[model samples]
Each structure stands twice: as structure tokens, then as C-alpha cells.
Target: MHPLDALDAAAHLAATDPAAAISSLPWLSASLADDAAAGRFARWGRSSVIDENVGAAVLPRPLFDELHARAGLEAAWPVGNAGLLHVYGYLLSTTPTPYGLKRERWLTGDLERACGLAVAALLPWIGAETLLSRATSAASALLARPDALTEEAEGRTARIALGAPLPDGTAALAYAVDGLIVTMFPVADPAAVRAGLGAPRLRWNAA
Candidate 1:
């Protein structure tokens, strides 16, 4: 099954039985509504819930991991490597708009930062033609950037450098339009992710 299919299924199940969904899935409820508001009944366990004092949404990593695992995705859909990070970043950073070209709220610094890393990770490996099929039209539209490259080879080697690290160890990689696989340095530690394998470069020669 496709990864998106699994995501859709999980979403559907969540919609049907929210309580059950939370129990079965990996998600934490986030309240975002304003409690001071006049009168509004809040829905529990909703991805996006609005109430008087606050609105809440569910932002959890387990959901992403479970959906990816269920989809039975192959190398073609490596959510772990990049897709998952991107999806998480987008959900947290952007607000859902009915007709906005880019559904994400670009203003949020944290979301923007996470998105920067996510883009850097996926830029090189993501097959353009492939993305068109998986990512929604709006996703594709917003994802479209001048820096995105297209080529048969070296697609995975593209590197975008997110120089220096933020207090939270966040950074962005900027790659040339050419082609190269830009590996996403793990967010856990900047130094660990940068340790090059140092394996001697291999070359093919006809004997």
C-alpha cells in the first residue's frame, strides 16, 4: 500500500473514533483556542480544535512513524529520511487555509526553521516527477522553489549548507541548481551528523 493510503486510513479512523484513535495512535492533543471567548464547545483529540480560551491540535511523531510503517513504503518513499520531518514541520508551522496558495504559516519561526531543515533533507533525493504524484497540488505549489534542481544523476548528492547552528541546533542547507545528494544532518547533534565517513573515494576502471 502507498504511504499516503496509510495516512488517509489513519486520518479516517481518527475522524471516526477520536478517543480510540488517540489510544491506538501516537498523538498528543494541543489546545490552541482562546478560553476567554464567549461560548464555544471544544472538540477533544482533534488535530485542530478551537474553543473559548484556546484552540488545540494534535502534533505527534508516532503518528508519522506509524503511517509510514503501515504504508509499506520502499526506498521511493523514505519518510524517515526527510518526508516525515517535512510533514511534521509543515503541520506545526502552517495554518490550514481554505484557498491559500501556501497553506503553511511562513511567519512561525520554529515551523520555518524545521521546514528549512526538512527542505534541505528532501531537496536532493526527492524525484521531481515522483513528488508530483505524492505531494498534494498545494504542497507542490508551495514547495516549488528556485533552488530545486533536476537531473538524472547526482540527485542525491546535492548539498545545501545551513551554516552555523541556532540555539536549538537548527540550520538550513542551500544547494546549487545542478545535482547532488544533500544528506540531512541529524537534528540530534550537529557534530555527529557532519562526521564524513572519510571512506576513500572509489573509482571504476576497465581492466
Candidate 2:
């Protein structure tokens, strides 16, 4: 199973069925737990950080760690990976549109900052490709700039072909693009996804 398999499944499902996406949360969280325990993702237990000082109620890390431990953990949204997941989860579930794309909101400063940690912790070692995938460059860019994300020319987030690597050296990008897809939501097309994501197309070695 890919580290991000659960997330990708939810993304595609949200494209059509958000109820299905919400219903799948327990299963998704369980699958995510397995993946984490498998060591692809280190234990994502609660962090000491808190974002309550601001108006945004980030899912508390302790609660996230608890609910995250099993498929059963549920709580108010605080600021952490679970908060990111929860925001997307609600948007994906309640929307009538595919992926709730047009409805997606840009994350607040603290939440966006939290994603910086998630992206770094989640990104895997990708191999060089003859022509690198969009994610490689995007990942490089997101690390440098959190507010800027991959968007299509029309300016909606697009899925940038990031997923499980082929296990061969040419596997391309990894956990990055998939994370952004649902975390960010749709723009217009894939090409713009790469462009709005910020970062000039650099050679794999250069990236």
C-alpha cells in the first residue's frame, strides 16, 4: 500500500461523491494508521504547539493523535495535520460539487504553516527521471514558499501526479502532489497546477 493511497482514494471520491468521502474517513484513517505504523510515516502523535490564540481552532494534536491512533478519534479542529485533514474532510464531504473545487479556501497562516511541517515530514526521497514529474519541482517550491501552491493557468489547484514511486529510480515525485490536491483543491488543469505551484521547471539534478 502506498503511503498516500488513502488520501488519493479520498481525492478521487470527492471528485464525485463527498458523502462517500466522509463515510470513508474511518477507513481512511485506519489505513493511514497502518501506513504510519508501517513506518512510511512516523507516528503522527500530537505536537506541543497550539493555535487557539487566533480565531482558527486547529484540531488539537493530542486529540488528533488519539483519534489518529485508531479510526475512532474525533474532535474539534485545531491546528495540525488532522486540522488540515479535517478542513478538507468537511469541504469534501459537504460540497455538492466535485472535489468542492470552486469552494476550497486558502488555509490561514497557522494552518498553512502547519502544512509546511506535514509536507516536509511526508515527502519521500524521489529518484531522478529523464524528465522529472511536476511534483519534484513543486515540492521544492512548496518547501520554499508555503502560501504559494501549484495552480492551473485558470488558477485552481490540480493534482500534479504525485503518488507511490515505482521502486525503480524513475519513480518520479512522491507524497507531495497528492497532498496538495485535496489539501489545496482544483484549479483548471494539470499544467497550471505545476505553474501556480511556483518554481521554474528545473532539471531533476538541479531540483
Candidate 1 residue-wise lDDT, 49-156, digit = tens: 111122322323444444333323222222232232233223332223332211132222332354433432232113332221222222232224454433233232
The deviation in Å at residue 123 for candidate 1 is 19
Ten residues in sequence with the least summed lDDT for candidate 2: 125-134
The 0-to-1 C-alpha lDDT of every candidate, in the order given, reads 0.29, 0.32
What's the C-alpha lDDT at position 189 in model 2?
38
Q: Considering summed lDDT, which 10 consecutive residues are worst modelled in model 1? A: 38-47
Candidate 1 overall lDDT versus native = 0.29
**Which candidate leads in lDDT?**
2
lDDT tens digits, residue span 1-207, model 2: 553455456555654554455356554444444444444222122221232223232333333444334433433434333322433233332223333321133221222222333322222211221001222233444334433434343332233343222223121121232233222222233344445646433211110
Per-candidate clashes, comma-separated? 31, 14
TM-score of model number 2:
0.27
